[model samples]
Target chain A: MADHLSEPFKKSAMTNEEIMKTQREMRIQFIAFAFMIALTFLAFIAVGAEVAPPGFVISFIIFLAFIQLFLQLYYFMHLKDKDHGWANTFMVSGLVLSIPTIVALILIIGVVKY
Target chain B: MSETVDVSRGLPAHPERATLEGKNKFVGFWVFLSGEVTMFATFFGTYLGLRNGTAGGPEAADLFHMPLVFIMTMILLTSSLTSVIAITAMKKNQFKKMKLWMWITFFLGVAFLGFEIYEFVEYVHYGLGFSTSAFASSFYSLVGLHGAHVVFGLGWVLLLLIRYNRAGITLTNAPKFYMFSLYWHFIDVVWVFIFTVVYLMGIGGG
Candidate 1:
């Protein structure tokens, strides 16, 4: 009589461990958000003044901006948490295409004139 | 309720319609952003090449105003922060706060644009119109593109507000909201480079 009857399964397969894991992920996300905002603001202020040595200052500010860009994409965009492979692939593609494209253009211009 | 979804269970993977179709839209927006990055890169490279092409005119040192650009930067940067607050409100399922915060961002963006327009007008008045020199052209092209972005960004969110006037936070609008935030960040990134390479370096060097 019982042979054909199937046992009832629980609706939620998520367990205490899984729930804890999700909570941990959420906690980490919040921490990352806070950290990104804090660090970007600090650097924004640090390089916040006018200075000499034009080339050096420009390079440093670019460096800091680049840092903030990375943070924004990683944390707020949540690329780190999800679709890691696809996001990285697209980002790398942009980097590869852009660097050589820019350099080559500059070199061509260099050859053309002063 | 095409505009509604149960994100109460720790947020949906995709919000607007909460279906495969909606998720696709979210993914599509990111791809579009990559293209935007490339477009900006082209402008950046062009500016670099033409920066010194002043053609016997005033130089970057005398051209750039540190104080004006500084205030403009703060306005745009804070606008980005406000946009985050908007999204954070959205995540908490608070649609009114989300809309209010988005409007705050819109106002900040408008203020930033005002300063930029004034800055450009000031530059042109000082014998530095686009036709004055190659330096003028490059400077305008670089910062002008940023100004254009701000204008478009304001219009973008406004359209959303109008279109979704009666709707709450949906999966569709959520990604729309998220994409604007991304755009806001990209705008900031470009500005950071502008401040450093344009104002700081230009003033410090020239």
Candidate 2:
């Protein structure tokens, strides 16, 4: 069929477009990588330098870690792209269910001996 | 190949999700990973709960080495980047580049396991053996399971390399490589939490 024959032609024709898209994606990936490294450095400095209050340092690094997790999941894992709705649903639900589980585990399983 | 069976000509843009088979594989792997997330969350919850139940043995502050942990974090984070590069190569259909990046990932994984083993040995030398306390048990369970995952991931990449060295970038092998990269990224994500909650907070005496 003509359609079938043209498929290969179309694929071949998209090389330039594909390369452009790849270049864009590669740029975003490099930016995310740099941000992750900077975040890691900040986390170490927050704890190692001992400049901030202990409570603030703990919360700050945890906050930075959450940002890193989001970048890893969305960018590195490609969860932010189209057609990943089910994957996103599953991950979000897992996080939702985990909150209660974690709360109960920490509170109910009280450190009686401590 | 026959026209009837080969619905798409050449490598599809998203070969890992281009066909019915590939879509099933892509979605199914995500479903499995969701469950895995819950499994690790349970381990993490257990660790947080029992972190202070040291049974009067060495606490986290007494055993953790921040500088060594920071180096390990860097190594693992770089390996994640390398695996991402491999995935990028796959997207571009650059088989040789993908293989090279995957090999780099494998070596980084091996290096991480080596450092982890050395870390465990150091902990034991410092008198924090397996049965020392509740904290010891949970820490090993959580972090040890992660190390086990890294070992499995390394073996997987090695197998993919061996089996597909001559096969090039076929549809059959693309999804396998894609999923392996996903798994490797998941390991790095978990380590991000470990260093944050375990090492940083521990050293901070929180």
Most TM-score-accurate candidate:
2
Docking class of 2: acceptable
Which residue runs of candidate 1 sit more than 4 Å off their true CA positions? A1-52, A110-112, B1-17
Report the C-alpha lDDT of model 1 over A20-95, residue by residue, as the tens digit: 7555655665675565456445444544554435456556666776776776677556667654556566665765
- Lowest lDDT sum, 10 consecutive residues, model 1 chain A, at A1-10
Per-residue lDDT of B169 in model 1: 68
lDDT of 2: 0.83
| Best model per DockQ | 2
Model 2 agreement with the true structure over A7-77: per-residue lDDT tens digits: 22223222678879877887898899999999999999999999889999999999999999999999989
True contacts kept of each: 0.18, 0.42
* Candidate 2 local lDDT, residue B13: 63
